[model samples]
Target: MSELYDDFKSIVLNKTPLIDVRAPVEFKKGAFLNSVNLPIMNDEERHEVGICYKNRGNAKAIELGHSLVSGYIKEQRIQAWSDFIDANPDALLYCFRGGQRSKISQEWLAERGKEIVRLKGGYKAFRSYLLRELEESTLHFKPIILGGRTGSGKTIELKKMSNAIDLEGLANHRGSSFGQKITPQTSQINFENNLTYELIQKLHDGFEHLVLEDEGRHIGNVFMPESFISLMAEAPLVILETPIEHRIEITLNEYVIEAQKMYECAGFENVLEAWQESIQSAMNRIKRRLGNQKHSEVCNIFEDAVQEQKKNGSYDKYRDWVEYLLREYYDPMYDYQIQKRSEKIVFRGNASEVHEYIKSVTLFSGRLK
Candidate 1:
């Protein structure tokens, strides 16, 4: 009998490679950050086998699975697994419940003179362990939320701190409709699991405090776990204050100039055109909030910027709408919200002062190096 491995901590800590032998559909729902889906059966085969199991029982289902996966199909899968094992020798293989699929995968690998360990309770057990850790990990750190208006450099300053977790980075979003990127955002499970890994690593490195952005429950479509969001809600907030002009510049660069560059880099046929459509869609999302009049003004300004960019390749024209939306739409909303949480404001300052204050607090507490 082969060893049944279940040291999930060591796996996560070591960044262990994982071979998920569950079908693609299962892997798509959720799996470890480090795990690759090299399934024993494809979705169709799994579906057929599932029906067989439901009707004919485990023995017949197992036989059907073998029959379906045999011949060149079996050879091809075994070779893929072998190649992965060669590259990631420390990798562990697993199925949904560490059951027949993983056992069969292991047996095949062994037949080819290759030995690989499979997880004891598999994906289900590992996922449960991670969720438990995610909830419990909140208790191990002191959280500080960095809050600011639309373009007040909250993410900019947050990244400077050694102890900060870039929630936006993890979610691949900037917490706005315009924040959607060229790449797809992570699935909710992937987001939580990635966060759990980050938290565990930080704790391992002896950091006792975590700094995060002042975001609502959802960032784009991904959201924080209830326990995690509860902690963030109660945590003290430090606001990063920047001059209005500077904030406009940051917003212009991030949403307009940088966004265009990203589209160009991704080889869009018409970079500005694609970016313009995206911005228009974002504006439409907040049409009700901006009201018809302000929304029309902002849209006109954006159209002017697009035309100006097309004419001279200058992004300076973007500032008008960017500033308009920041001052008119986002600023007042932020002000109202911040006023309600005035009691939680611990330190408010310019970026430099805010960074220094956090550094000092972290150092003084001796919780983080």
Candidate 2:
């Protein structure tokens, strides 16, 4: 027999590796940082059980679940659990609630001479807690938003600030049409969990100022908390400026070499082919904004650039389209948006100058390294 624990603080703060007994589909929807799913019932069986519970009642659901997952299937599940416990002795197990599924796993584990602890309120309770924690954290964060035109390397400057939170990085996105990562993005709940965790940690460390890059309400599919957005709107801003040539170099590195490294690391096959497909997809997403003729021209040039790379390893062919997109599309869009935000600007300079200004400012000074 294992103890049923309901200590949310310990469960969260310790971050013990979890043997999540939830069905694969449930796990995929949302999960914590250190979970290895070892479900007693697979997705289909879980679905059937859920339907039974809804229509036939809890007792009937239990009977149906037992019938569905018995004999060889039951033994296989217990064996898998045993294998994981053998490898991770400190691991805890939980399902939606510390109910039948988790309890049964515990009984089976005990039969195999292994002890397991279960979360009393399971994932639901903790997830509820996490949401509350996130909302409450907004009060403590004194956001200092980093505002700049595209390719000004706000992410670069953000890293230099000691109290910064990279929400884009947390979302595993670059926060733009072209910000796709080779690695799959985290589920919405998972993204929120990690983001909240980072914020709480910073607050606990006693950093009052939170620096963030200026972003829209949404980054890819991950939306910023409404509270955070309200905070950002009122935060002091530092706008970065760089020469056109410098912007071109920065954007080129991001879209090409740096992006390629991440793509390859994520196990993308035929990396060049992947890059071409991704580039085309990104361009298509912004087609309405780019307008028909300009969109067509950009796509044509992108295709030519891809062909050039495939031919003699010449990605220099991208320079024309990149420059055109910057001058005509991104620069104009940024200028229009920035014009509306004139009152928010507290400082404007290149990265080094901005860095110096941040160092000199009392609000951003003492904590920075």
- In lDDT terms, which candidate is top? 1
| 1-369: candidate 2 lDDT, tens digit per residue | 438876665555666778899999999999777788999999999999999999999999999999998999999999998888888887888899768889888888888888989888788877887788889988876677788878888998788777788888888889878888877787789888877777766776677777788988988888888888888888888999988887878888899778877778778878888877888899999899999999999989888888888899876987777787788789889889888888989999989988777667635523555
**All candidates: CA RMSD in angstroms?**
1.7, 2.7
Q: lDDT value for candidate 1?
A: 0.90
Clashes of each: 0, 0
lDDT of 1 at 151: 91
Instruction: List, residue by residue over 156-220, the lDDT tens digit for candidate 1.
Output: 88777778899999999989868999988888998998999988888887787789999888999
State the TM-score for model 2: 0.89
The 0-to-1 C-alpha lDDT of every candidate, in the order given, reads 0.90, 0.83
Model 1: residues >4 Å from true position, as ranges? 364-369
TM-score of each: 0.95, 0.89
The numbered model that scores best in TM-score is 1
For candidate 2, the clash count comes to: 0
